[model samples]
Target: MGMVLVSHSQARVRTHDKCAPLLPLPMMLQRNVLSDSAPILLSILLLFQNLTISSNQSDGSDGEVLLKFKASLDNPAALDTWAGPTAPCSGWKGVLCGQGRVWGLQLEGMGLHGAIDVETLAQLPGLRSLSFKNNDFEGALPNLTRHRSLKTVYLSNNKFSGEISDWAFSGMNSLKKLHLENNKFSGTIPATLTTAPRLIELALQDNVFEGEIPNFEQEGLKNFNVSNNRLVGQIPRSLSRLDASSFSGNDDLCGEPLEACPANYDGPTKYDYHDDRIRHHKFPETTIAVVAILLGAALIALLGVCIFLICRKKKSHQETAPAATAAAAAAPATEDLNQMERGGESAAPGGSEGGKPSVRLLTFLKEDSEKFDMQELLRASAEVLGGGVFGSTYKAGLNGKKMVVKRFKHMNQVSKEEFNEHMRRLGRMSHRNVQPIVAFYYKKEEKLLVTAFAENVSLAARLHGNQMSDHQSLDWTTRLKIVKGVAKGLLYLHNELPSLTPAHGHLKASNVLLDAAFTPLLTDYGLIPIINKEQAEESMVAYKSPEYKETGKLTKKTDVWCFGYLILEILTRKDSGVEQQADVDLATWVETAVANESSGYVAGAAVFDQEMAGGRHSQVEMMKLLRIGLSCCEADVEKRPEMKDVAEKVEEIKEREFDDDFYSSYASESDMLSSRGLSEDFRSINI
Candidate 1:
């Protein structure tokens, strides 16, 4: 719709039709002001501007703009609080207000998705910060370059894919702290991102970026990461001082903080080199003696080079000769690998060759898993599931069954034979509580793991994403079952894969899936062997264990400590995404909350999810479970109970209504105090 204009002196200003693009008010007024009969109209327009400015706030224009923006999301209910007559600055959720206007929208993990309406956001002239971190928003980012006034932008942990246009960040002058980590955004990182004069803290990890990095000149840049991507070439010198973890997960990247680049390497260069400059230089062969001397020196140098090459080749051959036999069963013939890369549709999923191994690169680990060839998987219609610290995950359909394909960028910790052997070992695991590996694909740049999709989604989604939807929140019984099952799964992993450190290395709510019956099954297990050491240390939940964090030590109890964090999340229904600056996790929060317990279980009750807190016995059971969790999470590592003990404690605590006689699982109050550091706070409360 076009803007309306009225002139007391014979109104004749033409208005564009609805289909036409709207022009800025100044441009619209300029067209009318320059007209032959417009001196009177121009003077009246000035009076109109004055009147418009006065009614702006009362007109509810900014709130209306946000409403339209909310409507554009696939799940608008995520922002239900953004509705109504209440001023956006006063009551709307996530709308940051200052100086009586909307300046920021900090929506994180509200389960919102779909492309945002950039035009609607543009209406708020005072807008500065925009955060959509940990949401499900997909598609290429909006035309956000126009939002030059923006300071910080967080699109991390979303499904936004494809290469951003080079001009996308060209006009973002005020930009800083751009976090596009944990997404499927591909192609070379936009060089125009350097245009932002205030740029800092650029996080581009867990993506599909390729080619050389841009020469970032911003002096203020402190936090940066391009790890877990398809990036190649030397990192920019400006970012070399950062920890090696920042550049992990990229196999081809080289230079300081990593390995040294080749001496003749021309950075970001596409052409082949052919150097012959030495031939053009004139030799100072003024005398026959000088010529003879030069000839003798050249001959001696050539002889030395030949001797070194012969020795190196002999040494390399001796070393590799033994590896050849050991690696024989690990990979297929070179021809077979080339054929697979060429998308040879000659073979079906399990059609003899998908199983063809370093011993089969495209091995179907499970005998019963549905088969598809390399070509089929490559061509399958896929949906982005989510991006994690490891890499991007997708839901792909094959043979009428849904399968999850998780891409990992840094599964290069071991040789190909060792990797295949480890995958086989993990595949043989047949536990009820563990998610089975359906199939796997191996390539130099990345690796893919496939498994059956769980219908109930992840435990994290049940506890968080669907809380506002029609889906009911998981009650105490279900939460208890999940933790029990997770504990059982850990027990199996430890018993079956005794060699693997912590057995289940990446335990978290998101990694735990729920079946139709609400049974918890663990996935992404035993991956510490393949993950890059630096990356695993930096991002994996197991690495966040108390002993590892404090002393750079990893014990058998490291996974138990991670399990404790999971218990805290399930009980409290609260989890802090790493994106948050506070860095306080659920375990720490529970520790602090329970530490301040006064009178009785009053403080401890506050830590549990309000929905699940009720019934005298249930409260007691929660306290008991809280104790178990804290004990498993104990910082001493020595005090933490074994997985068998933890599982037994969980099993001992059952629903109070069914059992005629209920008793505390521990031997005595003093026993609980000694077992867990968090138990002392609850001693005053008689449960």
Candidate 2:
């Protein structure tokens, strides 16, 4: 039920391909035999069965392996897209198909907290590569011998445990590269792994493997690392070509890479042996037991007392360490403190035993809760709001006050000091659309951040087809207001604030919440550092500026690009259809589409044709925005526009209006927009 990717080769099928004839007739027949809901259920089950059967019937498919993958996680209903037209493999979420078969399965950071179904994945005889990086998958990796065609396997940064078995990878003879880094794997490296004749790279670093390092004699093994483990014994001369840093962390290791093994110490047999016999007689067993019991009891009591005293001292220090200052000046410092503390918690370095790092919990008191819990707020409107990239949200009433209660999925990666400092900063901020932290509850593993609930839904929700209402259609005026509101929020993040802190690296339509007046309020305004990587990935995947991948740093320029994308979302009335592009090669499509749009060939094309199509957004305006977006999505971080310039250009376009004349003659008719780059939008007369 988790993330199970299966490959089945058919007569070739494209992204826009239609479904085969056999699958739908059963649904047609079921209409008479089952009730309304029953038919839906039956259809879902039938579709899964057909997919299983079809996959099994294939010469290259391994059904049992696929079944094991399906059993390793929660429901994988998100992957079921087989029915009316497109088969699931062609357009399913987290699937990549090429030449009528599943080529890769990249479910990286999908909040998929379950064990991997290695068996299921191995069934796809044609799978060239697979990656489940930065997820919450646990347990030992499954055997994958049948998938001899796999070129790469990236299972890094997971919770996978157990010793690396010889059979675990002995079957994958064709694997060119393997990444098992940053896991809890132990035991000695299997000598059989060295037998992979075609393996080019093997990364088994950042684990708990011990014992001697094996000499992987394969000449083709160009990149191999067994670093940061308890490995001992001498390194063979065959691996002398590798950098010494690769074998640095281990202590007991010796030889040329390290030093010569310690000389075998021979006892001074004649004198020492005679002196040992003259030593005092051994103590009685009863005396030893009595003394040991007394010492153990004393140590336990002393440890308890020390812990109690430490807690008391810590609590006392917190109370007297300076009272809360006014929100403006002190808020930035508080936010900074939170950031530093959170960063420390996240980067938990070594010193752990048993392969498990230690974790600390957080808690907040009710009596110490903030004053904004006004009841009338929720009384007027109370609804069960859903969860976001960070956590769940709910509409509430606080003494006639309406507010939003955001229940964050807390992790051991944040400390109490960080949470307190960040909350203080959030409390000081007072913006209309920007949700303020009204109250918070942090206890043990549970943490709840309460904010004033807004009247309107997220821009993404509004843009979604099923959720859009006639009256809610954002006309030109409302769209302008939305743009301005978002711009101002971003402006505050980039420049208006005393501290030049960038909004947690992402700003998509979903993060932009609307008030009753349709004013945009940026949520998660000051809570980025408190988020875990998995949670951050959920929020960032769509809105992430391209520079993030290269530098791994969040900057104001990144926010500007995100803001530009949000503007494009508003103008086009599209909810970043990033998730929908799971079937196609998104990187290729975006690049090609952006290029075509830039050159004016696809500039004012209808919404249906281009990915960013919709009558709500002006083609000329959308094209202009796309130009900005392409620049923002540029690989070079320094080349992107700043927020101030972005806001000004957007304001200018709104005033000038994007009409026919605006679309036709702005640039050359080349296949790609001239990489002419970005400039200041300082035209005195708007556009």
* Candidate 1 per-residue C-alpha lDDT over 8-27 given as tens digits, one digit per residue, 9 for 90 to 100: 12222233343468765855
106-203: candidate 2 lDDT, tens digit per residue:
87776566666665676675678888888878888756666767888888889988887754665455778899889999887865565465778988
Error of 1 at 95 (Å): 82
lDDT of 2: 0.58
User: How many residue pairs clash (N, CA or C atoms closer than 3 angstroms) in each of the candidate models, in the order given?
Assistant: 9, 26
Task: Quantify all predictions' global Cα lDDT against the true fold.
Answer: 0.73, 0.58
Error of 2 at 62 (Å): 86
Per-prediction TM-score, please? 0.46, 0.41
Error of 1 at 665 (Å): 18
Candidate 2: where are CA atoms >4 Å away? 1-382, 468-471, 496-501, 538-544, 577-602, 605-623, 655-687
Worst 10 residues of 1 by lDDT: 1-10
